[model samples]
Target: MPLSVDRLKTLLQDDIKDLTKLSEILNKERTALKERSNTAIQTLASEKSTCIKSIEYRAKEKAKMFVDAGYQIKKGEFEKAIAEIQDPSLQALWRKVNIGLRFCQDQNTINGKVVSHSLKRVNKLMDIVRGQHNKPNLYGSSGKENSFGGLNSIAKA
Candidate 1:
């Protein structure tokens, strides 16, 4: 069965709503990471997962609609199909959803970087507390092992 234009619009609008929520969650997650709030991070992680699942489900439904309408799901295929409908409102909604998703993706990338840096710091601290003398082998511009300027271990530094 061919999917109606109304169904396409609904999916796009739903994606816009969920993507907006996901973007907010990602921003909160970045703040939580900076504040080192474990509880808030955990809560936001769950919320983010749920929001992502909903977005994926909607995307699959939209793809199914395209396939049923005899169009191959590819880049620009959705816009092409929407153009055929000739409804400016639906096209606007599609653009909004696309922009929202891209924003969310950028936010998520930033949050991941924050988490990675935090983990590296925590690991370094852990090595320090454990009294492990694992000096970071940083090379200077001269291609030589840079000394720690007379510091014996991480604890002394």
Candidate 2:
């Protein structure tokens, strides 16, 4: 038997709630990243992973339901499914869920960029600190820019 409209509605509502929570977590993670708190970032990353898994599981369930019902899941398919209820109120509620998801996706992209930039900087610093950097930037006493290739000692430069 196909999934019931009420069940789908409930699932979508639950997903919206979960995504809202994920958005809050992402905000906290941004704060952690800004503070450079390694411990907080680690803990928040674990929590975020768990939350993402839950969201993906629910989304897969919804997709399977749609497929089983002879519907091809795609953009706007979920909204169409909800529209079948023919109730403006129900349609609006589910649309809110989709809109919330889209917002979350955009925020996630921004957070990911922040994380990537931070990691790249850390790697560059690590190279310099380890004396493995071939082109370490330095300012001379004349205030001219220079790159030290193999001089690991700052005092000798």
Candidate 3:
């Protein structure tokens, strides 16, 4: 059976709400990461994972509905399809969803970079205390990262 456009719009609105929540969580995660609060980070990670799972589930359902509507499209393409619909209200809703999705993407990327940079700092510190080369990397089994050797025992540092 073909899905109703109204239902699709409703789904998009729900997705926008989910994305907004995820964006907020990502902002909180950034603060926690900057503060080096491991406990807060663990809590934020759990919350973020739950939000992602829910978002994925809803997106899959939305994609399936789009397929049933006669145009097989990815979740993002569903927004494109919605934009072409004749109803202005649906288009407005789709616009909100699109903007919300974009914000979520930007925030997520920022959070990922922050996490990566923090990891590199930790690796650099470990290298320093272990009397290894002052490089930032967790892996040494591969390539130039293994240029220096760490003390066999951390206690010797």
Candidate 4:
């Protein structure tokens, strides 16, 4: 036997309520995921800035040493400067700093890519949920066309 209109309405109302609840849950999850992605991005940016500053400071220090050694060279005291300074330690420090900077840069890139990709996925899921909620099958047939008709009737006056 066919269901009564009241019974069908009740069933549709219940389905709509369930779908609304599910959409709300999905939105909450999407928000939380976006927050996590933002935090990861901020962390990556902070780490990158710190690494750049450290590299810049070390480079400045190395440049100063080079300048001082160059002055000694200009004064014909290159042998004394060479004798007094340990070039190997300076070279090793430069190499270590460069390697550290490269590692930090690589990590920043990786973390940023991961966060961006995750955010894109979250956005796509949010769009899907929104689209499902906005469909005529779920929300009934009262949409922009009805609003436009009302406006057109008013304009005919």
- Model 3 C-alpha lDDT versus the unseen true structure: 0.80
Report the CA-based lDDT of candidate 4 relative to the real structure.
0.45
Tell me how far the alpha carbon of residue 36 in candidate 2 is from the true structure, in angstroms, after superposition.
Answer: 1.1
**How high is the lDDT of residue 32 in model 3?**
94
Model 1, global lDDT: 0.87
What do the candidate models score in CA lDDT, each in turn?
0.87, 0.81, 0.80, 0.45
What digit string (tens of lDDT, one per residue) describes model 1 on residues 1-157?
Answer: 7767898888888898899899889989999999999999999999999999999999899899889989997888777888888788988998898889888888998999898888778987998899988776677899866545446575543
Candidate 4, residues 41-93, lDDT tens digits: the string is 45544554554454455445434554644533244343344334545543343
lDDT of 3 by residue, 20-134 (tens): 8898899999999889999999999999999889878877887788788787664466656776677898888778877887898898899888987788678778878899755
TM-score of 4: 0.39
Candidate 4: segments with Cα more than 4 A from true spot? 1-86, 132-157
Candidate 3 clashing pairs, residues 3+ apart or interchain: none
Best by lDDT: 1
> What are the root-mean-square deviations of the candidates from the true structure over C-alphas?
6.9, 8.7, 6.7, 28.2
Kindly report which residue stretches of model 3 are placed more than 4 angstroms away from their true locations once superposed: 74-80, 135-157
Better of 1 and 3 by lDDT: 1
> For residues 1-157, could you state the per-residue lDDT of candidate 2 as single tens digits?
6656676777778888888898998899889888998899899889889988988888888888788887787888766766776877667767787788888888888888888889878978998899984676688888865676677685753
Q: Which sections of candidate 2 miss by over 4 Å?
A: 1-3, 131-157
Compute each candidate's TM-score over C-alphas: 0.82, 0.73, 0.78, 0.39
